[model samples]
Target chain A: MPKQVDHRERRETIARALWRVVEQRGIAHASVREVAQEAGISHGAVQHYFATREEMLVFAMDFASEQTSLRVAERVAELGDAPHPRDVLRVTLTEMLPLHPEARATSRMSAAYVLEALHDAHIHARAREGLTHGRDLVEDLVRQAITDGHIDPDRDPAIETNLLLALTGLTPLVELGVIEPREATTTIAHHLDRLFTNRP
Target chain B: MPKQVDHRERRETIARALWRVVEQRGIAHASVREVAQEAGISHGAVQHYFATREEMLVFAMDFASEQTSLRVAERVAELGDAPHPRDVLRVTLTEMLPLHPEARATSRMSAAYVLEALHDAHIHARAREGLTHGRDLVEDLVRQAITDGHIDPDRDPAIETNLLLALTGLTPLVELGVIEPREATTTIAHHLDRLFTNRP
Candidate 1:
């Protein structure tokens, strides 16, 4: 009897390989052959999952999104019901940034996909979807803070949330050794202090 | 005799061509042949200028730095002596961010070079040099603000200046259409208001 291969498992394995390659090689060498070599699978088998380079790239981006979203959801669940908006914002944003190795890999992959977004419409939509989703989640948290009276009633949630998200997403620069991590922490604390106005 | 070439002028023209190509196609396609085609010059002519891809990339990055530095100096000169610290900070930062096409092109080329920095040491140094120079300029401005009594004495100039430079560098996300320009401008204005309390 022929051996059965789990296609889904194979795809995940390939995506993990893709992330590893992108993390180390900066996404320029992430060809199917390269990923296959990294995954210890045959090139033909990898292609059996992704038909084109774009297909492979799109799949890799979606995988990154799923991984990040899962991590965010898990962290949120641990906060229990009606968590503080500030904590929610901190966890979600920090998770998205490249503070540690895992986050850095994800961030590097994100940078790759974002550049791809400029050239490919499918990747562009996926990149936009991920960013919009992140913005909405953070926006809702800001809205909750308003309802809970943790901030001034007069504060514009949209503009404030945009600041939070942009500032938060910048941690990757720290990981790149461009900005000192200590400085990024201090800067973030300063902004967060001004943003909530009523932090406990 | 072959046509006489001014080496300095030829290099500048090639650098401009590289920027135009990088502006159009992300740096991944910024190969010598492609750049030569964009410049309407022979590939051999381009090769006569840059022996390798890294050579070409480094030239491009230096060109970007020179362009940005020139713009910053011109803006600062317009402010004259004893300029308000707030205005000085605002002008230096707004010039760095991608609020217009010229700034956007520089920012896009920057994002391209930054990824390459991960794998190329020469490109890495160029990126770091540009960033460090920007930080030093902003830090001096921040220090001047302190002397001018525009901000609280207790504020740490290092941390605050780090915040200012990092936050300002991120406006390209606005140019990417990820964030609305209006929102970015408002958020930046809010931060500046807090940074320099004694504004004009």
Candidate 2:
């Protein structure tokens, strides 16, 4: 009997492959042929799923975002009931960090998209929208922490969220050798401690 | 009599034009013709100075680094006898922020090169070396602050320096709408205050 394949699952698998290529080789090299090879499919099969390179990139970005959201939700769910706001914030914030392999790949792909976005308005808009949604999630978490007394009530949640997201951008800078990794991690840890310790 | 153009000065002027084109239109769009048009010079004149687009870009990066060093040195010199490390750090770090028009343009050009550096080894190495030098400057400032008792002696200067540079990356992220600008600034202010004040 022939192996059964879910079309949706197959598309997602192909998207993942394309994302990895973008992350490792850069968006400029993420051709349909390359993605197809990475996905262990024929170039024509990849073309069948994604008519154009732009379409593949767009789908890949969406796939990455969905994966990110799912991971955050999973981590949040694992906290169970009456979780400390700090713990909630840590899990949420760390999910966005390039600590895990998947997150690291996502970060690289996102960074590549940022460069591509400079020339492509459609991609730029999508990237900006994704970033806004991510920031909103962080803001919501910060607000929850403030209300729960896990963070300083006087602290501005919006600003705190923004800082956290900004910190997220640091990982790529370090990875790109623009800054030292140790320095980046330590600095982030210090900032988070001060931000979450409920101290003035 | 016709105006005499100094070859060295003209070359520098051409490099600045390259920077501006990259800043406004992204690095990929910064061709010899575009740069020459922007500089109000002949396309042949650009080749006489830069040989190729890559050479022009490399020269521009060096020029930017030199300009930054001079500005920081001047600022430090202005602080002669009575030195407030907090104030100095604030001013220096703020100078790096894309708050002003010129700084914003410089930042865009830098970001464009950063994307190029991802694939180009020579550019990547130069970026790495320059970044290391930047971190060293920040580290030196932090060390001075420690000696003067502006920052807590026990506080890790290296980490603090990294944090400052990380914040630099964050500024553009905010400007690009990848993060909320208000939130980013507030977070940075809070972090800086904590770093200098040693408050929890």
Off by over 4 Å in 2: A1-7, A10-14, A30-54, A71-83, A91-101, A178-183, A198-200, B1-7, B31-44, B70-83, B178-186, B198-200
lDDT of 2: 0.73
Tens-digit lDDT track of model 2 for A80-108: 98676666666665666677789877766
Please list the C-alpha lDDT of all candidates, in the order they appear.
0.76, 0.73
Q: Which digits, one per residue and each the tens of the lDDT, describe model 1 over residues B1-200?
A: 23445876787788878877777767777899999998899999999989987898888778777787788778878999977777666676677677777776676677778778877777777778777776777788788788878887777788777667666545535644778776677777777887787654
lDDT of 2 by residue, B1-200 (tens): 13345766787798788777765566766889999999999999899888988888888888877776677667777888765776577667666666666666666677666667767788888877887777787799899878877788988887777666667757546555765555555667776776787422
The number of clashing residue pairs in model 1 is 0
* Candidate 1 lDDT for residue B141: 75
lDDT of 2 at A98: 70
Weakest ten-residue segment in model 1 chain B by summed lDDT: B167-176
| Candidate 2 residue pairs that clash | A159-B183
